[model samples]
Target: MAPAPRAQPSPVAVAADVSSAPVSTGCGNGGPTTHRGLAAATAASRTMYWPLLRNAECRHGLPAGLLDALVFQESRYRPLVVSRAGAGGLAQLMPRTAGDLGVINRFDAVANLDGGARYLRSMLDRYRSVPLALAAYNAGRGAVDRWGGLPLNRETPDYVRKVLTFFNEDA
Candidate 1:
């Protein structure tokens, strides 16, 4: 009788394989990003910023349209605004989320908008679709991820539609 030897992979090879795999950048849909794509995304943007979205946009590499849509949906550029749900500032970020995003004062227009934009960029990267990203932003990423799409939350759909339909004047 004869037996064959089984070979095991080396640690270096394994490490190489792991390192060579694609990594999520946590910006713009977890897909490849570029200033050009970002430029296109924000191409239709017409928002005025106290600190200017251009800086944040350049920092996180987000499409301007999506950012503008989110801002319009959340607070319509009112950094001092707060939702009944406790979302606040121009981006309508919750206190905890805002804090995690490095926003010391959510009511501050610059801080809020920057934190919100960063969060939205992450959502876009995670979901890879504008509607899904908007849904995650409105209903929480857990809900969108759990439902395998937009959550069943009543307001999520409306939020998504409103953000996506920013092109329509009446929207």
Candidate 2:
């Protein structure tokens, strides 16, 4: 018997006009960092960036909600986020990687999503496995090459699981 089809979640429209919605850092301990606050922020971000996310998904032939899950894991849709490793924007792209991906302004939401999606597509093409591709995205292509599969490292495996879980749940 065949498996049942997955139902994709419809994009929820924000009550406030998207153009006027405030952009939150989606991180840090400062401000209203409660669970509800974070959920609200994530929802707002989903609405605000739905168009860009969908565009990236279509352009890169990525499974629906995959980029959204990655974005949620990376920066929670914060356009101004900078990681401790110097990764920035909604996709948490490192400076070198962003430049290599032709993303001049990593802080720009659209460009960041495009670059991240492109990078993920490359990984998927190379590895031909969602878990392996996600592992490479979280760690690096070099690491995936070194391990020749999903690395046994703690963070990479955990990251892959979380992203996949989110991706499946969002479906």
Candidate 3:
């Protein structure tokens, strides 16, 4: 038997994850909440990457706060973090994905952010659904196809919820 069709998330939930609307192209408009989220990160990391994040946002038409939320979840703004799965840099891109996205140096903050934003834009375009796109980002597109929605696995759903939480906080 096939898996049941998943219920679509509400529009507001989708928008909160990633909005196409023009907003200040930085994390949380430099609000107190944004600072609170970045409190764990070092000052240099926060200062150095905000502009790159903004640039990626403008170039990819992503909302900065959403992108910021994603980066926070992915690596906590640590440019050199390498996952056990070998995903690295601020975006935590895997090797194959980094190559496909034309990111030569995954540790290079600018390249990683740009590649991540580009890949995210493509996912959003392909799925036309924020949650599915986020699931695809976390668990890969093949899993999304196989599961017919968010996977039953714990990581993907938790990832979506956490990223959405950060995004909603405008962090």
The lDDT for every candidate, in the order shown, is 0.62, 0.72, 0.75
Q: What is the full ranking by TM-score, best candidate first?
A: 3, 2, 1
Pairing residues by index, what is the TM-score of model 1?
A: 0.67
- 15-91 in candidate 2: lDDT tens per residue? 12212322222222222112333487787876788778777766777766678778988998888989898999998
Once fitted onto the true fold, the runs of candidate 1 whose alpha carbons sit more than 4 angstroms away are: 1-51, 167-171
- lDDT by residue for model 3 over 25-113, one digit each (tens)? 44334422444535654545656688788778668876546677788889888999999889999989999999999999999999999
TM-score of each: 0.67, 0.77, 0.80
Answer with 1 or 2, whichever has the higher lDDT.
2
Q: For each predicted model, how many residue pairs clash, with residues at least 3 apart or on different chains? A: 7, 0, 0
In model 3, what lDDT does residue 81 have? Answer: 96
Model 1 misses residue 39 by how many Å? 27
Best by TM-score: 3
From the highest lDDT down, the ranking of the candidates is 3, 2, 1
Off by over 4 Å in 3: 1-44
